[model samples]
Target: MSVLADFERVDSDSGGAVLRFTGNLSLASLGDLPDRLDRVDGQVARIDLSQVARIDTVGAWVIHRFARDREAAVEGLQPASRHLFDQVVAAEHPIELPPKPESPFVHLLAEIGDAVFTAMHTLYGLLGFMGATVIAFWNVATHPRRFRFHATVHRFEVVGVSALGIIGLMSFLIGVVIAQQGAVQLRQFGAEVYTINLVGRITLRELGVLMTAIMVAGRSGSAFAAQIGTMKLTEEIDAMRTIGVSPMEALVVPRTIAVVTMLPLLGFYSALIGIIGGGLLCWVQLGIPPITFVQRIREVVPLDDLWVGLIKAPVFGAIIAIAGCFQGMQVEGDAEQVGRRTTTAVVQAIFLVIVLDAFFAVFFSQIGWI
Candidate 1:
């Protein structure tokens, strides 16, 4: 097709210049249009479209781009040509947008509001989950045969038995380090024998259960989220619901009970192992014999200290289980969501465990139990 188009300067005796459009001003006839437009570089005081026989949107756009900032007056446009020109002109000189500025205090307030809402929403979900779990337990209590015995046993093995070696080793190492450090410090006051008291009281009252809870939150809590999240992704939970199975009963209760049942036992075992490690360290490094260390521990460490750690264990276990299961239930069948929820479960479980531990400490101190 002939892409023929041209424009010319109409010399005017008046003060301003005029540009006259001639020939087919259409896309097909737009040859050298931009270059030709560039040639009309001087003042464009007027544009006369009356001589143009035909034009298209592209031609309209070319004219608009050329004349938009030139303050030129256009004349003799038919209705259709005027509409096209108006469209192109509006497009070329779009409305300018202004920026909105925010104060730093307002931004900080918005962030705080968002965080508070998120925390409240999480807490609400956890309460709902706890209620459902309680109902599931009630059902199992009445209909004993409906309990998932095999699943509970399996979880006990996974959450309890599988964790023993690492827990024991970590507790032992901690006890050894504390004893060694305590001996060095106490020797400054010629009271190195007090190392036994430090190891016994700290292990039985705080470190053993606290460390176990933290580890289990990272280990079993994440595992719970991953497992339940995978099941959620595969729609197994939905399928169970359709088949009249309560997911709380089938999935959540068994895991929760298993961990709750096993945590106190594990805490006791950890405390025992830690004390043994400390005793060994004392015997080897401080020249205090194992029997003497054991006697010292018994005399200095109250039975209440052991009870304090034991009491915290089951509560920590329940928090870990609920956090994991709650996050798992919230998963959206996405791989990224599964990973995110698993991480969230571990973090929330650990945070709650620590917070609960703190409250317990305060309560114990207030009641003179410390």
Candidate 2:
């Protein structure tokens, strides 16, 4: 067992106080010594370690702290103890507190700036990706044998054929709602017969293509991102490069071409189904026969409206495919990034589609398509 550390204050020959320590000054023997030292009030000229039988790092730290706080000189330490004490003193450093937090208003402004910068960076990257896609398309155009026919056909089924049931159902419901609401408002002014015009024109010129684009953005766009992102995570994309296969030609081009070709057909189909639903609703509520309704639609809805919708469809499809594939190609690091990119693909596609639709609307109106 080690002797407990003890200390006594004495008058020194130099006419000043000295703290004389005794016993083994180790961690186990240091009980109450630190507290006793802290209670010491008088001026301390020196700390005497001559009678200490042994010492450890903990003991050195305690002694060094007391000596430092009192500005007293240490005396009679053995060589090893002196070396340990010197090391303890050398290792001591001031603790750094955390920096103060910024004000909420400043933080909000910083966040807004960061968001704007990120959006600009994303736009630049999307433009670069679109250029790459166009180059890939040119390559395929130059070498027709390089096209992946089976992959593109499969994508056609996935992006177009498989979506028919849900898209048709949604469009039918939208048409019924539009007819019903238009009838209610028109009936107020005895203009209920104009409901046919409302349903036909809106379905063909705006709602039909716009709604189909939104659905495709949510469905096919997200699928492209997830599929490509998974391939990237599994290093299949890298392996394709190793095998001299171009990912852009093999994967991206097929999907892009599939979407670009199928979207117009799907939009037209959606518009036709919506018109049928409106006709059914008109027959049920207003007692208008299907033949009369069809005749009225032919007279009221012009060829210009159908042309407008068709013109927008391919552009919306291209935007959806490009956004999705671009986000997928950007995926790196982990599986979580795949999910984030997939969501971003859908949102980005939808946002761009709406913005372009608005631009198309303005352009068409200015050109007297209305």
Candidate 3:
């Protein structure tokens, strides 16, 4: 049966048109309303629903949008329609919602405690994951064919492929920024030639690995959380245990190894690009030719600095991959929970990387490594 929609023209002024409707309103007929309204070709449009019969929230919502978009105030909507109209109006501009009241200090404290407990549960899960990872590493050697190839593949994909661009881009940009800043200081001291020493030292020992770790934490850590969290949500992790398969051996080991092996390579690549970027910027800043900058790098930066950077790169990678796999294995509840944990993994990984860098800085300083 075809349902009829009825309307009457209310009034027209030089500005626009107003249409009043009297009808049995339903969603089936209203789907075309918004498009029809858009074809209005009128500067101002007004819709009156006072005479509506059996109007629903959906119908009223559509009209409400039309009126709101025209900035026209609704008047004479049917009682039921008015209720629906009011709701749509409220939705359109929630300016009428009461301001949220602040919680008392005690209430805030209770919430924090609840949050802490939640964090502990997640950490408890991560501990289980770490245990599994240790066993998985053992399994890799014992059960060689079962996991070694898969682990290698995962490493190549997650660590090698996913992390390339971000590390390189950031490293290059850092090189440029460091060179610009270093040039200023060197210029003031009339030691412009030593800018190579500053750029090479900073990039090799700290910035390159540090930057790459941050990127991986964001990229790989989040990936781990997302993948594992999703597995948790789907009960795949539980299924593995049910089948006498270990989640750690099956999951975390491959990922951890991937990051551990690839991060150093990525960091090395980033450092080279960054050094070149720094050299370019230094050349411009120092008004020296590229050859001079290249010569200074060879003369000033000892090979030891390069080794220090390479060592730090793998440590940073370990931190990122561990944190990601740990946090991911910790997930509980829904998909949203998985996403949140993934974010936490990235943050914690970045924070730990920085802390580790500080430790390295102090240790390297003590050894006169730099």
Best by TM-score: 2
> Which scores higher on TM-score, 1 or 2?
2
Predicted candidate 1 versus true structure: per-residue lDDT over 258-356, tens digit per residue: 889888988888888899899999999999998898888889899999889988899999999999999999999478999999999999999999999
The list of candidate 2 runs beyond 4 A from truth reads: 1-47, 50-62, 66-96
- lDDT for 361 in candidate 1 is 97
Order the candidates by TM-score, highest first: 2, 1, 3
Clashes of each: 0, 0, 2
Model 1 regions more than 4 Å off: 1-59, 62-101
TM-score to true structure, per model: 0.79, 0.82, 0.66
Worst 10 residues of 2 by lDDT: 8-17
Model 2 gets an lDDT of 0.96
Most lDDT-accurate candidate: 2
Model 2 pairs whose backbones collide: none
lDDT of each: 0.89, 0.96, 0.78
Candidate 1 vs candidate 3: the TM-score winner is 1
Span of ten consecutive residues with least summed lDDT in model 1? 1-10
lDDT of 3: 0.78
lDDT string for model 3 (1-370, tens) is: 4354456565576556777766666776565666666776655556666666656767777666777678876677656667766776676644578867767987899999999998688667656766766777888779876685766796688678877777778888999998888888878889877778888878887788788888888877898888988999899999999998877777777778888888888888888888999988877767778898788888888888888888888778777877887878778877789878888998888887899889988998899986
